[model samples]
Target: MSLSSTPPNTSTPIEDPSVYLDDPNRKSLEIDTDTHQGPALFRWLTLGMEYLIGAILVALIVSVSSNVVGRALFNHSLPWADELARMLFIWLVFIGAAAAFSRYEHIAVDALVRRLPLRLAHMLYLLQHLIITGLMMVMIWGGYQVLERSSGRSAIMNVPLSFISLSLVLCVIFIAAVSIWRMWVSLNVIRHPEGER
Candidate 1:
């Protein structure tokens, strides 16, 4: 038999993004939530946040595209387009981050943790979530202070600056809550490893 010269195809198959968006069971979209390991409250909250993020993204696209079209075709810009797009983008980034966190979609290096004993792995997880919660708390406090000092409205849209600051506060609040829940779950697993089975 003659040896083939072709190299093997080792690339992973790419998933269709629209399939997840259109699926009724959105829970399957998440990596680790396939077995219903996440709490019900968070599942609902994540679904709602995903919808909100999608709406904000669509609005942002429309806002920016309309401005571009107006400028190109009419030689004039929509006065409010820039401000509206900015606000939507801010909300999108903050809320998208919270949603991604809930889905455990952020970049992570957990190869070592995966190989460790259950108790030790969970202990590490608890510590990690604790740090995240603490940082989120600090962000929440700082965001509130900014909101208090933000007295002016957006120049074009007449929306209060505090509205923008509120998105940051809300994002951290969701992340902090999720971190606390994860910490509790990790502590439970550490205490009763059998219960996890």
Candidate 2:
């Protein structure tokens, strides 16, 4: 992909790969999942979550690397590394799930929707998002119940297993919020004929 920054007085001819100059300050981009404009709090929360997940990933990598080097050099593995990796992975799975859902990156069959008429397609899209929100709601409740029943500590780290419960709850809540927002936007799209998406 080609990208160029134009000088204040100069304008480049539009050619080659398509470019979207929607936001003047470049706070967000057309190619980014942040293009879905919503509440400021929601956007900031998602942005913060993305950064938090990235940090977790980096920590996981460092933990694994240190553990491996320790094992090879001193013939001893850092027991805490295993638990750290496991916990980080658990958090990653739940946290990354929200971003994926918001960006519509989840696997889905779209051929049927693509074939439908504009109105029907939007309706189906709204219904799909609503269903996703409902499912995530269920998951939140079930996850909470499960967390309530859990009392075990980690085998090596001795940390309470209940710690990861927050991750599950937060992820599902964020996913549900995004689905609801998308459903609202889909309804608006249906009301105003914006030609098909």
Best candidate, lDDT: 1
**Residue-level lDDT tens digits of model 2 in 87-153:** 9999999888876665455676666665566666777878887888999999999989979988988
Candidate 1: regions farther than 4 A off: 1-36
- What TM-score would each prediction reach against the true structure? 0.83, 0.76
lDDT per model vs. reference: 0.83, 0.74
Per-residue lDDT of model 1, residues 90-196, tens digit only? 99999999999998778776657656777777888889989999999999999999999999999988999999999999999999998998888788878887666
Cα lDDT for residue 152, candidate 1: 98
Question: Model 2, clash count?
Answer: 0
Which stretch of 10 consecutive residues in model 2 shows the poorest summed lDDT? 22-31
Q: Model 2 segments beyond 4 Å from truth?
A: 1-36, 194-197
